[model samples]
Target: MSDEACRLDVWLHRARFMRTRALAAAFVEAGRVRVTRGGVQQRVDRPGRTVRIGDELVSPSAAA
Candidate 1:
């Protein structure tokens, strides 16, 4: 899907989305991130999904 379908957990950590791979996988399984398709958003669940730079992640603000 991407240059290579990255392990979502690894991408999340490399992109600074989570402190650890485990946390990234947890967030993904919990439906905390959104994946865009045809300009529509969908929940991301699988840890093996492809991700890319500039892909929006729907995470709660720390202040919230």
Candidate 2:
């Protein structure tokens, strides 16, 4: 996390991935999102997790 870090759910919604913040948080809580940065990749199980710029986010496909 950094000074500019934002909540993962908020970022997801701001990025236009989900139509609503609640949905974004739900998606993250379901462990359907993964983040990769600094050569580290891990699942996002908590919507409140801190996300910073340059962090790579991977979401499950619609068909999943």
Off by over 4 Å in 1: 1-5, 62-64
* TM-scores for candidates 1 onward, in order: 0.69, 0.86
lDDT of 2 by residue, 26-62 (tens): 9999999899989899998999999888988887795
Please give the RMSD of candidate 1 to the true structure: 2.6
| lDDT tens digits, residue span 1-64, model 1 | 5575566788889879689999888888877778775567778888767766556556665345
Alpha-carbon shift of residue 58 in model 2 (angstroms): 1.1
Candidate lDDT values, in order: 0.74, 0.90
Count of residue pairs whose backbone atoms collide, per candidate: 0, 0
The predictions' CA RMSDs to the true structure, in order, are 2.6, 1.8
Which lDDT value does model 2 have at 45?
95
